[model samples]
Target: MNVQSNPVTASDTNARVLSYAEAIREAMAIAMQADPTVILMGEDIGVYGGAFQVTLDLIDRFGPERVMDTPISELGGAGVAVGAALTGLKPIFEFQFSDFAMLAMEQIVNQAAKLRYMLGGEAAVPVVFRMPSGSGTGAAAQHSQSIEAWFGHVPGLKVLQPSTPEDAKGMLLAALADPDPVMIFEHKLLYKTKGHVPEGSYLTPIGKALVRRTGSDLTIVAGSIMLHRALEAAEKLATDGINVEVIDLRSIRPIDRDTILTSVRKTGKLLVVYEGVKAYGVGAEISAMVAESDAFDYLDAPILRLGAADAPVPYNPDLERASVPQVDTIEAAARRLVRREV
Candidate 1:
């Protein structure tokens, strides 16, 4: 089944529509086929097909050596992946749940992030860490946190949060190509979302943002699932004469400040939305970027940020829905901003 109604064309051929998970698997397959040094290491990624089944059937294609499954210890697997990267192997490590990444902080934050800098740029750590992140699956507090901001805060590591199947496939390839360590936070709810994806290898440049919709009144900057909701909000606002511009922040770290500033400068108002908590989160940094730049002069309203409440995600579906910004909430916020009510 084609997931995208309007598939992007690559050259003269129409691109295939694929789900986010399928796109990611295709990217890994393409990379592994092209490079012998490329390897995949994660718990149950081989025989069990990974926790999310994103790595299903890879073991049969690449065999046990390249698609090696490790013990359930995230710390051990992450450390070994870093070691392999340091030794000239391109390793893609998958964490069952992003929350498990917290267990591997020492290796990711210290060793993976600082090794090249410590060695005077003499070595390259070409490692990609992929994990299922975000709330909406009733996974409760421990597993549903949107913690991309935590890694984005680090200097040397590059953090990505792709919102579409196309971006998911492209960004994964780009992450593998990078010389430094890259963290890819895949939202659990978005795994089934479909979009047009190219058949072969393609790189969606890191540190760039995509403008999902353009308008002249207010600009909405969002990442991951929030971007999708922002687009839906934009569509809803259009019927009421609120032309909202929506920017998809595909990459969290090294954010595309230029795109954001340009959009804000055009719209004269900015609303930053994220699934992460509002306090000191990704939106805070984005709001600061605009405030500190020349874009501040163009803002007709006080910059607003809509994010999840500063608390652990609850398991109850209704409570979970209330905790994070939804399409209606975004629409309400945009209307308030446009009407000069807030």
Candidate 2:
């Protein structure tokens, strides 16, 4: 379907249909062109053009010096990025996959995050680390893990996950501008999906929630690919006289609590959905916030959480689908929370 979007005028009609990966590359291109200090460092990012080819053609434009490909060492490479950021360069590091970030947990969680505060604002690390996350591509147990909850627990660190093309561009720009370290968890499945993104420079403010859909009956909070799934479930639920509000908690850390509380107070019902395991995911955080806030009195039903099981992401396609929350899972959970029988 040809979707009508806000179009921006360019010098030529070279408006080629671009994927999410291309949108991200465009953001990097624009940022690099604007600032010489913004450099990319990661394994295969320079010559191999990244494991996902998201950094393709960047080396040719910026040359090998700025676009560097390091050895197969997450911890050492992350340390390099931290040192680079300390010495006045904005380094954008790419972990081949989200699971690899665990190898560099000390650099990210302790040193990079606590530098400014520990030194009384003497040292600042303006860095953006990109980690392709989630379990949709059959990457199995080791390569796939939704560990945003881990980063969100740390102070002075921003954790962002973009669910759309526009966000993919906007959030990256914002991450580069932050004085502290920002960890971006881009889901693997969203790479091929396309959406109309604005031309020229743009930035989506960090620590803000986006209300994707407006309604009065119920509010559904989600992030990453699950945000799109919740929006789909909202459309189907609408046909049955249920109006659902969809909130995309774009930034997991320093979450937009006001937006969430306002939505719950207005809608009176809440459903939190995500692809991460339910035990300690973003859903649990939001659920606890609502329970403790004044919004608790406004709840018409118990806050519901729909997420992956505690087990590892299965290799089998059927079990994989069953492992995480999908459209049907979201729909069923919403129905039960709203007291609607399917």
Candidate 3:
């Protein structure tokens, strides 16, 4: 994208507007400057500034050593990052696109997930993987996909999907501070989106969901770009007096069950939206969570799930848009469920 947003430094006084990429860059800079052990590893992250330019100007601020670019192999790079974490260095590895993570499943799912347990807590793997994920960029099937649910199913890894610039910076800092492996699924479409991000270092508490809008008629839960879509749908539905409540599901793996359950009980209706395919996706997990919990009794209607189409993401813009849930679709689904139409 080659956006030239100014870099965030500690000396800045007030909260400033920043793009999602700039915010992530600020978090990496802040973490690297604060801790010498913190380093960055990714393909073309140094001078090339990452595939989406999220790491732009980072190599200059921290030098090439701290912001080391690795070979083109995702598996090799991932294995090295995991080893770096075990050998007393905190490595933030960025995958050009999350779809490439499949090549490194052995390192991420096997080694990073089982080391501590296999040694009975004698060791820790504090690695952070920053992956640019989701559709809408016309990267087609090979590059456009939402795989947070894949890593979320793994026990030892923490999966986060921060939608706003504020949460993007804070949650990345939180992941850096965590003692286990963390996967941050940053949506490609959100890279240039802007929001107010506070100065200095901060941590958006891991595993906590934020109530974006409060209402009592229906509850809408989503993460990443889908969360923004849900919010937009909620706003439009508000004028019709639908009174939809929106929740930003910041952490996927360690889900904020209490927040979801509380909202479901208050609203009496639930709608889970996600960008992943309909079957075995995040929507299903959220639906099942409320269904299995005491919140089931509070449900005035059946929980509805709005997810991506089963077909691969198409290069055609119209087809790509049709494959994923959009604002209109989300609003329609929420309206139907709240009105007892299902």
Model 2, span 1-342: residue lDDT tens = 112222331212444456778879999999999999999999999768898999999999999999999999999999899999999999999999989999999999888999999999999999999989998788899887888888999998999998877778888988988888999989888888887677777888899888888899999999888988998899999999899999887999889999999999999999999888899878889999999999999998988998889999889989988999999989888988888442
lDDT of candidates 1 onward, in order: 0.90, 0.88, 0.90
After superposing all C-alphas onto the true structure, candidate 2 shows an RMSD in angstroms of: 2.9
**TM-score per model over all chains:** 0.97, 0.95, 0.96
After the best TM-score superposition of candidate 1, give how far the Cα of residue 334 lies from its true spot, in angstroms.
0.6
Provide the lDDT at 295 for model 3: 94
Please list all clashing residue pairs in model 3, or write none if there are none: none
Candidate 3 lDDT over 1-342, as tens digits, reads 221212432224466889999999999999999999999999999999999999999999999999999999999999999999999999999999999999999999999998999999999999999989999988899999998899878999999998888889999999999999999999999999987788888888899888877898999999888888988888899899889888889999899999999999999999999998988988889998888999999999988998889899999999999999999999889888977997
Model 2 bad stretches (over 4 Å): 1-17, 340-342
Best by TM-score: 1
Q: List the lowest-lDDT window of 10 residues for candidate 2.
A: 1-10
Error of 2 at 260 (Å): 0.7
Which of the two candidates, 2 or 3, achieves a greater TM-score against the reference?
3
State, as a TM-score between 0 and 1, how close model 2 is to the true structure. 0.95
